[model samples]
Target: MWFTAGLLMAGAVVGNAVLIGQMSGREPVLVLARDVAWGQPVSGDDVKTVDLPVEVGAFAVREVAQAGIVGQVAGRNLHAGDLLAPDDLAAQAVPGPGQWVLGLRLEPGRYPARGLAPNDPIAVHPAPDEGVSSGSGTQQSGQEFPARVVHVSPPDADGAITADVLIPESTAPAAVEAAVGGAQVSLLGPPQK
Candidate 1:
């Protein structure tokens, strides 16, 4: 009887241990709290920790890794509830030195609506029918400075697409002045090759 009772007790203990192990929850991981635009900084309020299965969150950024997420710019447009990861963040501008960061407000016809994204190269030109000087003096309608595409804001109330572009400082003032002087500036297309 004593041996039988001991074996029963041992079985019960082992059974309890197995049950506890199986009932344990998965690790908590960081997920986006709201939609974030490209190049926007991530703050503590921008993320939340949630329990996710090991297999699902294995490649995700864990809650422990959320500490350094602040000040990191979004590498792409991030939707709400997205699983945060290292590749989703960037260190701001990747443009070369002495480049100008300028905002260009474009109407629907001025810039391409498809396949355009950040980090793409752009060619500058005078908007169609605007013969105002493009600062290059001779190449009035030809390509201007080779610029880098940055953030592209959603269409505003006026249906204009606002974009942040990086161009050489040498041509920055002249290009902006022309735009301000009622001379239309259009980014024709991404540089070929």
Candidate 2:
């Protein structure tokens, strides 16, 4: 009697395991292969497939659903390894190869209280009247360089913000110069996207 009961319990455990496996909604999904910046194109090279439970997240795009991605643009900065979602793509910008994207740190006094928003046109200039000294210990000044804000970090404990800007390659050197020389970037308002 004891042997029969043990065998029945083992059989029930195995049967339950098989039933759970069948119900486990594991599925294949296409997630970001790498960090795709704001407005970048979504191509096959930017995605990869992996099996995940059915309830991944809202807007999750499946691997088989990638046919609609090739020409679509990233609506915002897509971090590496994030699950690709439908709303993440749109008929928005695809940053050209000639656009240079970079970051700059700015203090509360240096940038506007309203702050820069993504895709907002901006101009980089050495913070006016700063009289800052450079690496050579000589006073340095910089001029405005046209650019667009790609992303803006929320203020830290001290209220400083870091902004990522995209500018034409032809003017990247000047933008870097202005930033490194203590620049202040002006947010022109109204995001382009």
Minimum summed lDDT over a 10-residue window in model 2 is located at 125-134
TM match of model 1 to true structure: 0.62
**Per-residue lDDT tens digits of candidate 1, residues 1-193?**
9999999999999999986775474788899999776666888888999888778778788998888888788887778899998899887644447777787776666676572466566665544335655566543443355565677788888767666777788887655753443223344544469
- lDDT, residue 39, candidate 1: 60
Candidate 2 lDDT score at position 107: 82
Error of 2 at 169 (Å): 1.0
lDDT of each: 0.70, 0.78
RMSD of 2: 9.0
